[model samples]
Target: MTLLDIKDLSVTFNGTPPSPPVRAVDSVNLRLEAGETLAVVGESGSGKTVTALSLLGLNPPEPVCTTTGSLRLDGTDLRTLGDKEWRSVRGRRVAMVFQDPGTALNPLLTIGTQIADAVRAHERLTREQARQRTIEALEQARMPEPESRLRQYPHELSGGMRQRAAIALAIAARPKLLIADEPTTALDVAVQAEIMAMLRSLCVDLGMGLILITHDLGVVAEQADRVAVMYAGRVVESGPAAHVLKRPRMPYTQALLAATPRLDAAARTRLVSIEGQPPRLRDRAPGCSFAPRCPVAVDDCTAGVPPLAVFDGDHAAACLFADAPVELPAARPASAAASEPGPAPTTDGPSPLVEFDAVDLRYPVRSGALRRVTGHVHAVQGVSLRVEAGRTLALVGESGSGKTSLTKLLLRLERPSGGTVRYDGIDVTRPGPADLRRLQREVQVVFQNPYASLDPRLTVRRILAQPLRVHGLDSDEDVLVGLLRDVGLDSFALDRYPSAFSGGQRQRIAIARALALRPRLIVCDEAVSALDVSIQAQVLNLLADLQAEHGMAYLFITHDLAVVRSVAHRIAVMRHGRILEEGTAEDIYASPAHEYTRELLDRAPGRRDAPVAPRFSAAGDTGLSPTTTPASQHTNKERSPLWRR
Candidate 1:
């Protein structure tokens, strides 16, 4: 039964009079059946999110906006519906789980109150009745201690818990359809696996049609039944999830696959990055927007936009040469700069670039009205690590695992409670102002959220030049241009603000700023966690090249094991402010000594050998069914085989 159908859908956002209007979503078609999971995969600005929003009449206000074509739900034309009619259908029939739970949830309200309100709004329920259902909903979402969580505000919960609570609220009234946007973007590998499994299970158990919008192909592979690949506001490819993922026909889709790092793939292999950026919506190139970056482009590809051609049953692609083979590289070229040798291993090193001799970081846990220090939160305890010049040391852990705290020690943002920190054989643990200035000049950081890391008010030129100016160095146009060029950006980006650039481009700008100070060691805190694989590969390659050329060391902190495998020489597995295991990257990957590290490796997506284990419930149950089945046909009795383990 077709639950939702959309055809020839186009959405345009009005720009200033001097600029052309932006067609964010153009000429797209999609169909969803009950219990179907359709993953919409794309980078930022691909219009996947906008398309999802339009289905619920949630697009930004007009005359700044206009949407055309048909959106039918169960044979009812949604476009013809009045505001009151739409409101009736919005939550009771269709519900949406937004990207950021921190923003989606009401910060001021308790979890129970907020969910009760959602239920009350959609159903004729009293406060007590709504509250009862809210508890049930929380339990259904697998939230631990549902009763206690009801009284807690959004800020009191962990990120994963907050998301789960939000999902509970969305599913409270038992909507027939659900749309989740980047549901697991901010979670760790284990948590992400759990969330994906939970969502997949919900779709099966409730028989809900799900439209999942995200850039993480791994999640799509693990959870989706079908896939739609979007690029520059259009669906470039659509097919069975496995078929499209294994043998993508569109050049863009092919590039995305090749760019992603697989856990099964060998370590330190250079990633295949698609050159050039996606076209701006306002530009609206005459030919296929992707032709500008297509690896297999031809003269015909530039003539006109190709209509989607069908092949292999339901599979389709919008490329003139859709039948052409995708020439995915067996491995990145050996001549690639990332493959070059770095300085000797720390064990055989001249003095290490940075060192921590049994460093301990602790925070006083205050409580009550009197604000007494009840106890200490040992953020980092007896952590000893070293990074040789031009080498990379990766710190892998879940949230609250002391990764950030350790970096704070390095940045001098927090002083150690015990032990010592040394740099270049100097015990400048408590550096004076002049020493601190010198230390700051030699150490830099690239944060996860590039926009937040960058000053919003500063232009690209000023952002890059500020570090130079602070260091009493020349801030010439040539210097700024050179910085941009080093990070694979052009001179034209100089005049733009961080808001004007894409997530990938903004990260590059941040990297440029980090490089401006000629830092000896760079601390990357989940730096590429939010990027598309292609952009991530590009940035990793750039970092490798910089390290090779300048003898810079990287203290790489991230939850992504695949990325860590690509860049790090040594690996440290941390948990609860302690290093569970530490060894050469190869050693750790081949054979992890700690059970926790092994579990982390097992949970990493994109692996063919071992399936990710479903998270054990708070009650310590495996939550597995004896059998497995397709999502559409799955019953509560059928769970993924990984769950059985």
Candidate 2:
């Protein structure tokens, strides 16, 4: 049965004077049937979420926004419904699951109360009846101890538990359609798989339609039945998951598949990054929105907008030359790979850039208003690692595995409770006033969440100039332009703010600011975790090129092991504030000696042979390999897995 139908739908948002009104969604058509999952794939600000929100009249109020076109649910047109009429359809017939559960659930209410309230809002149910229904909803969501969890608040639950509770609330009324917007984007790989499985099961058991909005193609491959590729507020491609994923006709879709770092890919394989950012909604380039970045773009591509042309069965693509033969940039001859230089060479007998010697960072667990120390929080314990000059030391672990604490120790954001931290052979554990200034000047950081890290009020030029001025370096226009150019950005970006740039461009700006002082050591804390695959590849390559030119050392921290193989010279696997295994990148990838490390590797998705965990070849074994020493030199004795309660 056709559960939902949308045709020629367009959403427009009003902008201030001097800027044209933005057409956030333009003439998009979609259809969903019962017991089917349709995945909408795109980067940030691509109108995926906006289109999802418009389905149930959840978009922003009028005076600033307008939505037009045909939208029907079960043969009834939703566009003709008034506010009061739509309320009956929402929550009872259609429901939504937001990206972040922490912010979605009310902290003042218990989990059970929220679910019960949702039940009561849509149906005629007493408190006791609602409570009973809530328990059943929680049970169906696959949440354990559903009865006991009823009284617990949002803060008392783990990240995974909170998301499950959110799902329970959404399904409380047994809505016919469910829209999950990046449901597992914030979850670990294992938990993500579990959630995806649960969602698929729910769709089958409930016999409901599902629209999943996400950027992770891996998740789509694992769960989605059909796929829609959106770009600049348009569906560029639509087809079965297998066909679109394996034989993408649109260049944008092909680029996304090529740029993603796969677990099965050989170690140090250079990711094929799409050259430019997506078109801005305000600008909305004429003809094809992807023409500027399309590798096979021709003059005909820019002549007019191409409608979605259907091909074999349900497959369709919005490209003027979808049927024409085209060669991908990455598929060029081996001579192209030979021209690019490898990773920066490390100096023999050189001083370590940053060293942590048996570091232990502990905090007192306070209770009551008197703030008595009841126990200690062991954030980092006996963690020892060496980051040599001009090399990348990747720190890989799950969330709350002390990755951030380790970086904090290196940044001196928190004083270590035990052991020492050395920088350039100087003991920086307890630096004096002048030493602190020197440490700050010599070390810098680029954080995750580029939008949050960058100041919204400051222009790009001022942000890059502030660091130089603070360090008493030249802050001239030439210096600013040089910084921008160093990170593959043009001078035109100098006048823009963070809001004007895409996530990838904002990260490049962040990298430029970090280089303003020419720091010897950089702490990149989950820098590319929130980016799209193509953007992540672009940023990773940019980091590599910059490191080779500047000879700077990097403490690259991330949970993405596939990305680690491409950039890290050494790999350290951490669990519960302790290092389980440490070795050269090649040795660890080929054979991890620790059980915890093996578990992490096994959980990685898209691996060809992952039973004993995927094995990656060392340098010189694949194309675009990063430079590395033989595995025998840096192998360390494996330690027993730490206890986690």
Candidate 3:
């Protein structure tokens, strides 16, 4: 049976005078069967979230926002439901999981209280009954310790634990339909695998339909039964996951697949970046929204919007020439072919750019109202590593694995409890005032979220100029323009604030600021993890080009193994605050020595060797069979004792 059906749905936000109303979601159509999984994919502002919000009647009021057309759930028209009626349907029949659990979950309330409250809202359960239901929900979500996590607040839990708590809350009322928006965007690969597995299990056991909204194609390939590619507020393509991913009819879908980095691709391979940006909502043209960026677009494509043409089975695409033969770029070399040995590092070469000799970092653990010290949280253990000049060293690990702590030692943000940290042969662990100033100028960092890093109040010129002015360097217009040009931006961007630019553009601004002081070392801390695949390719290419031109070394820290394979020359696997394996990327990828390293590789989604289970059968069966080996069974083997602290 159809769990949810939407046809000719349009959402428009009203604008003030002199500005046209913005149609965020345009005449969209979608359907989901009970226990089926549908994935909605697009860039940041492509109407994915707006369409999901429309289902729950979460958009602005009638005057500020206008919604029209059919939205039905289980044969009932949802568009006609009033405020009180909608409230009853929200958590009982449907629930939504947001991208950032940090924002979705309440910070002041305990995990148990929040889940219990949600349970009590939809059912006439007593306090004890609600508490038991909350515990059951957490266990069903595969949380480590459902009973012990009741009193912990959101801030006390790790990223993965917090997300699991959010999932628990969403499922507390046993909603039949679940909508998850970028559920694992910020999680590590291992944790991401666990979450996806748990979600798949829930769909099978509870017979719930799932709508997954995300930009990560790998996760879609592994988990989604059907795919809907949205662009500029329209469904450009939709079909079975296998057919759409393997034989995409739309240019946009093909471009996205081509741009995604694969684990088998050769290192330093340039990714194909989509040329222009998506059309703005207010300035949307009459024809296809993607016509401006489509490679094979012609005059006819701009004449009128193309209808969704159905061809092979249920596969369909909205394009004038969906059957036309197009030439795709050649595939990158395989790992075996690209593993040819390069010049090996030797002691005779110039001194290492950065070195950590038996380093250790520990934070004092405190408790009670008086905040008395109990023990210590060993964030980093004795670890020795080296990054040669003009090279990229990837530090790979899961959350709470001490990856960030090592970077803190290198940046001198925290002094090590043991051993020495040397930068250009200078002892950086405890540098004097003069040496600290020099270190600051020579070492720069690009953070994970550009929106949080770049000041929203400042324009592009001011953001870039602030760094140069601090170092007493030239902050002239010519220099600023040159910086923008270096990162593939024009001078027109100088007057615009950070909010005006996309995620990729803001990251470019951050990189330009990092280059203002002519730093020799750049620390990219999960920089590209949050961006779309197409934008991620563009940023990675830009970073590679800049490094080649300036001969700068990079400490690229990330949990994305596929991305690490494409960029890093050397790999270091850290877990439980210790390095388990370190070697050349080729050697490590070919034959990993440690069990943890192999587990990380095996859990990475979208690998050719890994086979995905079929989500549905030929008889139109929507129910999926649970995996024989539950993901929770591996918890004890994968998790370390340190995580308990």
Candidate 4:
């Protein structure tokens, strides 16, 4: 049965007097059925979320764009419903899980109270009844100790735990439809897998219809029954999840897939980046939104918008020339997929520049008035690895793994309880004040959330100059501007604050700050996960170039296996504060030794493609699913398969 349907949707944002209003959403149409998932895949500001918001009449009428559409839920037109009715239908029938749980949840209230509000708003329930259901909701989301979690504030929970609580709140009313917008963006890979599994199992058992909005195509392959590609507020391509993915008909869709880093590809091949940025809702172009960067665009593409047309077997693409074929490079060479190259350095180098010699870190779990350490939380245990100068060492694992803890040890942010962190000949764990200061200068860090790392009140100039001042180095405003420019910012941005910049721009600023100290070692913690495909490409390339020039070592920590495949020289798989396995990127990819590492490889995005071949995995990836189902049904045969490389 059709749970929700949106038809003839259009949204226009008000602009300054000179230009026409920006069209954020065009005549879009979509449908959601019970017990199925519709994956809305797009880059930032492509109108995917805007469309979803419009469907629910959730957009702010003032300041923001006004929407015109027929939004129906179970044959009742939502647009015609009055405010009071909408208030009832919104939470009772359809609920939303926003992107950032931290912001979505209020800090002042306990999680229990927040969920109680949601339940009470829709259903006529007693305070006690709502509280009991709230605890149950938390449990349903797989939260540990649900009863205690309800009393805890949002700030008290970790990223993953907070998100799970949010999901539980959304489902508290037992809504038939759930809109999860980038639900797993801030989570670690392992946590993300758990959440995905929870979502999948919940939907199946409850027959909840799901609208999953995200950038991760891997999520789509695993969870979605159908998929829709959105760009410039328009549906560019769509079909059964497998079909659209396997054989994307739209040029935009094809570009997106090619550009995305695949974990199964060659270790050193440059990312297939689609040049240029996505269009903004405030000032979009007149023609095809993707025309500026499309490789096979023609004059007709710019003349007017093309209608979505059928390609094959339920798949449809908006490109006018969906069937007009030209040769596109295989996604990855088949050979590149099956094997990883050895650690043959680009140049003859001294033994790895940085090595962790049996590193172990532990923190005391305190309790009661005595404040005694009851037991220790083993954050990093007996981890050893080497990072060669000019080479990138990617530490990949799920949450609860000691990836961040290990980086902290390397940077001396945390003192190791056992073993040592060696940089050249020195034991960094016992760094003196002078040595620590030098380490900060020599080993810079780019934090995961640019928001928290940067001072929002400080302008770009001030932010960039703090490190310079710390090291007793003085420079004029011009020098700050130069640093900003070096990281791809313009002089105009120098006066702006952190809040004014996008995530990608903030990251660039962070990188510029790291470079200001002229660091020899750079630590990247989930640096590119928040960015869209195009911006990720630019940052990855810039890092590679800078590494070649500076001969610095990079300690990259992330859950993204796709990026690890492309950028890492050596790979260390961590699980619960222990290094499960450490080896060259090629060996880890082609022949992972540990079961945890194998499971990670399976959960990675964009690994399966057309022309994929079966390969023997004698190393035993016991943690991963052995069944090799076709990842995307619409994938073309031209792309090289990483499995057979």
Candidate 5:
């Protein structure tokens, strides 16, 4: 049963004279069956979400947007549906799981109340009946302790859990089609897999059609049956997931494929990034939307729009050269990599950078008006480890595993309960305020969400320049412009507010600001997890080059093991606030001694020819290779793992 269909769909948003009406959804066509999954993959500003919003007639009419073309669901024309009729179809037949679950949920509402309300929205079920359905909904989403979580607010759950709750709500009415927009973007690899598995199972068991909107190819490869590769406002390619991925026809599709980290193959070279930003919706290109950055784009490509034509094996590509042989594009120019690096990624080192000695961190738990001392919860147990300089030390664990707490201790954000952190023979754990401040300058941080980390009211120039201002260095406007230019952001962008920039662009600005201090340490918290593959590689390569030049140390915190292998020189596997394994990246990747470490390595993204984690430390007896050791002596990789936790 073809469940939903859209043909010649065109949507436009009204704006000022200079700003052309946004051709957000330009002459698009789509079809979905009763039980199938279609992945709409693209970077930011690709009009993927715009098309999704159009499906439910949920797009706001403000600025007086216009929609033309046919939109039908189950042979019913949704465009002619009145407000009441449209609302009836929204949750009862078609549902949506929006991106950013944190913001999507209502803070004041309990999980049960929210789900119950949705169930009650369409049907008149008794309180007891509604409650039962809510519990079952949570269970269907695979959220643990569904009953207990019903009373919990959105804030009480972790990012992964919150998204699951949202899924539960979306599925409460048992819709025939589920539209998930970046649903798993906030989760770690293991958690992402868990979510994907649940969604796939739900589709099979319930005969539900799924429309997944995301930029991660791995996610699409795992869960999608059919893939729609979107560029600007058009679908560049559409076919079976395997066929589209294995033999992409369009130049943009090919680049996207080459750039994505493969789960089965070893990465042979630096990923090829399509240089330059995506085209604006208001400024539709005269020819191909991707021509500016496409390596294979010929002169004819610029003449007019290319129609998506049949290629092979149920695949269609808009590119005229879709039948051409597979060709890998040349590497983007060098200065381009540095000058245009979007986000400042915490670089990986090929050497050991940080060492811990008998480390223990505990926060005093107090209660009562008298503030009587309560039993202390050990955040980090007695732990000792070494982090190679210019290399990455990936810390993998769940939220409560005390990952951030341990990082705080290392950064001197909190004094350890008992232990020492040594950096190149300097004990920074108990450093004076002045030294600590200087240390902070060298150890910059790139947080998970760019919006929360960046001041919303501030312009790009002000944010990037503020770092230099605080350090009492390079205050000249030209210096700031040069810095912006170095990070692939144009000077014109400096004048715009952070709200105007996309997630990836804001992240780039964040990287540029971090570099303003020229620090030696960079602590990344889920850095590239939210970015597109092409851009993730661009940022990753920039970090690699910067590390080669500056010899900086990275304390990378992520749940994604794929990134660990790609960037880490050494890896310290953590579980339940304890380090499970510590070894050179090679040992961790090739011959993981600990079962936990092996489990994490197995769940990483690319499986074939995957770039094994960088080996910053040599492992003995195991015979695993190590990252290069510095010229200095006395530093041993075989040293005891006991330092400080």
Candidate 6:
């Protein structure tokens, strides 16, 4: 049975005065069957979230926003429901799991209290009954020690635990439908697998329909029964997951697949990037919304909007050239030349740019109102690693595995409790004022969220110029323009604020600023994890090119193993604040020595060896072979003594 059906749904947000109303979600159509999963895939601001919000009637009402067309739930019309009616339908019949559980869940309330409150909202149960039901729900969501978690607040739980709690709250009333928006976006690979498995089990056991809103194609491939590809407020394609992923009819879908980094792909392999950004709501042109960015687009594509025409089975595409043969850019070989020439190498031989020697970082665990130190939280322990000049060493680990703490030690943001952090043979655990200034010039960092890191008030020129000014370098307009050009942006972006740019563009601005000081080592702390697949591809390619030209080393820190496969020459697996395994990327992927490393690789989604349909291939491609290095050539240091125990 069709659990939910949406037809010709158009959601528009009204603007004030001179500004025109924006049609955020335009004439979108989708359907979800009982006990089935429907995945909605799209880049940021592509109406995926807007459409999801509409399902719950969360959009602004009246003159502020307008919603039209059919929205039905189990043969009942949802559009006709009033505010009071929606309250009964929301938690009782349908529920939603937001992306960030930290914000979605009240920080002050205990997990049991929040879930019990939600349970009480839709049902007339006694306080004790609601509490018991909360524990049952947590158990159903597969949260460990469900009863013990009741007293813990949101902050007290780990990221995975928080997400599980969020899921439990959503399912407390056992709704017929569940909506998960980027549910596992921020989680590590192992935790993500567990969450996805738990959600699938819930769908089967509860007979609930699920609508998964996400940008990760890997998750879609693994979890989604059907796929809906959205772009610029419209469904560009929709079909069975296999058909859409393997034989994608829409250019946008194909481009997204192509841009996604594959685990099978070799290190330093260039990714295919979409040329332009999605059109702004106000600047939307007529005809196909993706026509401007579509590589196969012709003059007729812009003549008028293309209808979602069904061809092979239920597979549909809103493109004029859906049936025609289209050429997609392939992943370039590792030998591809950089865009510009860089300065000659200053160092000779296999000199280490950055080194962590038996590093141990510990924070004092305080107790009582007096804040007396009772013990220590060992964040990093006996982790010895080195990054050679121009090499990329990927530090892969789960949250709280001491990855950030290691980076902090390297950047001199925190001094190690034990061991030395050396930069070019100089111990940086404690440096003089002059040495500190020099260290700052040579080291730079790019954080996960560019919007949070960048100052919204400052213009792009000012952001880039501030670093140059601090270093007493040439802060002229020409130098700034050159920095922008290096990152594939024009001079017109200089005067615009960070808010005006997309997530990808804001990161480029951040990179441009990082480049201002001519840093030797760039610490990318989960930089591309927040971006769309296409945008991530662009940024990865940009980073690869910059590294090739400038001969700079990268301390690439992330939990994404597929991305690790695409960029890292060496791999270091961290857990419990120690290096569990370290080797060449090839050696680690081919034959992981440690059990933990194998578990990580196994849990990672979108395995090429899976029985699912093959990845979308480019024309005249014989497949890019992964470049490998002998294990003997790449050093594997001794493990920490704690690992033996």
Q: Write candidate 1's Cα lDDT for 1-645 as tens digits.
A: 899899999999988899889999999999998889999988777898889999889987778898998999878898888899988888778898887677689999999999998888888998889988999988777777899899899977765678788888888988888999877655678777876787777778888899998777777887888999999999999989977887777877876776776676567766666666677788778888887766556678778999999889999999876776444432343244445545545555567778998999988967789999999989999999888788889999876678888988888789999988887766657777877888889989987656567888989989988888988877887778766755557788899898877555787788788878878889998777767776776677667666665678899988788888888889999988999999998899999999999999888876653222112222222111223211212221232121112
- On residues 20-55, what C-alpha lDDT tens digit does candidate 6 reach at each position? 999999999999999899999888778888898888
Each prediction's Cα lDDT score?
0.78, 0.76, 0.80, 0.74, 0.72, 0.81
By lDDT rank, best first, the candidates go 6, 3, 1, 2, 4, 5
Minimal lDDT window, size 10, model 6: 635-644
Which residue segments of model 4 deviate by more than 4 Å? 15-21, 81-83, 110-113, 124-132, 144-148, 188-190, 280-283, 311-314, 331-352, 369-374, 422-437, 459-518, 605-645
Ranking by TM-score: 3, 1, 6, 5, 4, 2
Superposed Cα deviation of residue 248, candidate 1 (Å):
1.3
Looking at model 4, which ten-residue stretch has the lowest summed lDDT?
A: 636-645
Clashing residue pairs found in predicted model 3: none
**Candidate 3 lDDT, tens digit per residue, 483-534?**
6755546687899899877655687788778877878899988877767776
Quantify how close model 5 is to the true structure by its C-alpha RMSD in Å. 9.1
Highest lDDT among the candidates is held by which one? 6
Better of 1 and 3 by TM-score: 3
For all predicted structures, in order, the TM-scores are 0.86, 0.82, 0.87, 0.82, 0.84, 0.86
Put down candidate 5 lDDT per residue, 1-645, tens digits, no spaces. 898788988888877787678877788888888778999988777778888888888877756788889988879988898888888998888899987677678999999999999999989999999999999999877788899998889977766788889999999999888899988766766667777788888778888889999877767776788899888888888988877876777767766665664433332234455456677677667998888766556689899999988866588889877876345543322343332223343566333456777788887767689898887877788778777665567787755567777877767678887888776556786677777777868778877666667898888878877777887876576667755644456677878898877666677778777767877778887777667777776666656656654566678888766556556666787766688888776677678788766665566544533322211112332111133221111122221111000
Which candidate number has the best TM-score?
3
Superposition error at 634 for model 1 (Å): 50
Clashes of 5: 42
lDDT of model 1, residue 603? 88
